[model samples]
Target: MSKIEEVKAKVEIGKTKLVPALVQEALDEGSTPAMILQAMVDSMGVVGDKFSKGEIFVPEMLIAAKAMAKGVDVLRPLLAGDSETSLGTCIIGTVAGDLHDIGKNLVAMMIESAGFTMVDLGVDVPAEKFVEAIKENERVTLVACSGLLTTTMPALKEAVQTIKAAYPDQKVIVGGAPVTPEYAAEIGADGFAPDAGSAAVKAKEIISV
Candidate 1:
């Protein structure tokens, strides 16, 4: 099989020790960094789908994400471009009372790879902190709020409303296990992404509008 395919397979199985080198080898074998990165991201999608199907649990998903992260570290420099021409800053965090960050971190990585400077507020972040981040950062174009629990969904709404109220035109995107597109619209988010890859695409789409 091709080196890129090997990279994807290793990432899917959560081979943390092998993915980085395989990613670098794929890069050396005339595979562009973006192509290798996409392979790893696709692996994560497969992992997520497996998780959704109950074929894998949180530990499995976390390890797969870790493996993908390792592969990404190998491609980060090649994936990132000039910051001055960036799409703009994206403020991302898991909403208040939610400590889940694997999904948040994955979205941050993908969005950063898509060329936005990311200001990650970390987990259990209050809604006011998002506004504070936007106000403090220049060219802030997107705010992404994540909530993995049904219980924290309200925190997600509070975050979107707070940011929108503070800056009427501010673009907000919301997601996590329980967040649906309809609920996102109901809660005032400009966009909703079901996964990290789509989050990057949606972030770019939001900023271009």
Candidate 2:
């Protein structure tokens, strides 16, 4: 098989140790960094789908994400764009009372790869922390909130409302398992995405407006 396909397969199976070397080999074999990165991203999508289908559990999903992350580290410099023309800083975090970070970390990685500098607030973040991060950081054009549990969905709303109220023009994107496009609209979020790849797309789209 081709090096790129090998990279994808290793990532899909959560071969954290081998993915980095395979990603490097893909690059050496004339595969563009973006192509290799997309391969890994696609692998993550398959892992997510498997989870959704109950074919794999959280441990498998998490391992796959870790493998993808390792592969990304190998490609980061090549994948990154010129910082002088960056979209802007993006502050991301899991909403208060939620401890899940697999989704949030993936979104942050994707958004950063999309050319936005990211300031991650980590998990269980309070609403005020989102505001503070915006205030403290320069040119924070987007705030992406993630919540993995239905119970923490309210915190997502509160975070959006709090950020919007404080900075009326701030662009915010919300996501996680329990969040929907309709709910994002109702909660005053500027955008919503179901996964990391689309989160990057939506983040770019909203910030350009």
Candidate 3:
């Protein structure tokens, strides 16, 4: 198999060392950093597909994301500075009343690995804060919300409504343990993801549209 394919498979299997090793090998072989970065992104793309299909769980996805991140660090200087290469920008946070952030953090990292610039707002973020962040980062095309509890899920709706009221063209995406596409649609969110890997895919799709 090709080196890129090797990286993808290692990410799929959650091999922590394989990612950095593959990245180093690619660099030593005279591969451009952009090529390595693309391979890393494509690796997560496959991981995202598996996640959406329920072929993998959160723990596995998180590990794969971690591995991908290690590889990205090696390519950042070479690729991140290339404005022409990035897909878009994203603003992500766990909605107000939700202190749990492992899931949200993973999604944020996954989105970053997908070649999007990410501004992570951390946990327990209010709707107004999201609005303020969006106002400041005009390039942010996607607003990703995470709420692991049923009670906190309402904050996702509030954020979506608040953003839509101010910026009618903004897109809001929701995710977390308790969030579903049905609930997301009910709350007027633009999209929904069940896991971090899928969240990356969702961000890519939403931003491109």
TM-score of model number 1: 0.70
For every candidate, C-alpha RMSD to the true structure in Å: 4.2, 4.3, 2.2
Model 3, 1-209: lDDT tens digits are 77766776787677887788887777887788888778778878888778778988778777887888787777777775687667767899989998998988888878887888889999999999999999888577888888998888778889888988988888889988888789999988999988777788888888773
Please give, for residues 1-209, the per-residue lDDT of candidate 1 as tens digits.
Answer: 99999999998888999999998889889998867876775676677667656788767766777887788778778767644436789999999999999999978866765557789999999999999999899989999999999999999999999999999999999999999999999999999998776777788788873
- Candidate 2 regions exceeding 4 Å error are 79-90, 97-118, 135-142, 146-155, 167-169, 175-183, 191-209
Single out the weakest 10-residue window by summed lDDT for candidate 3. Answer: 79-88
TM-scores for the candidates? 0.70, 0.69, 0.87
Return the top candidate by TM-score: 3
In model 1, where do residues sit more than 4 Å from their true spots? 82-90, 96-118, 137-142, 147-155, 175-183, 191-209
TM-score of 3: 0.87
TM-score of 2: 0.69
Model 1 clash pairs are none
Q: What's model 1's overall lDDT?
A: 0.85
The model with the greater lDDT, 2 or 3, is: 2
Per-residue alpha-carbon lDDT of candidate 2 for residues 1-209, written as tens digits (9 for 90 to 100): 99999999988899999999999999999998878877876687677667656788767766777887788788878867644536789999999999999899878866765657789999999999999999999999999999999999899999999999999999999999999999999999999998776677788789873
Of the two candidates 2 and 3, the one with more favorable TM-score, higher being better, is 3
Per-residue lDDT value at 123 in model 1:
100
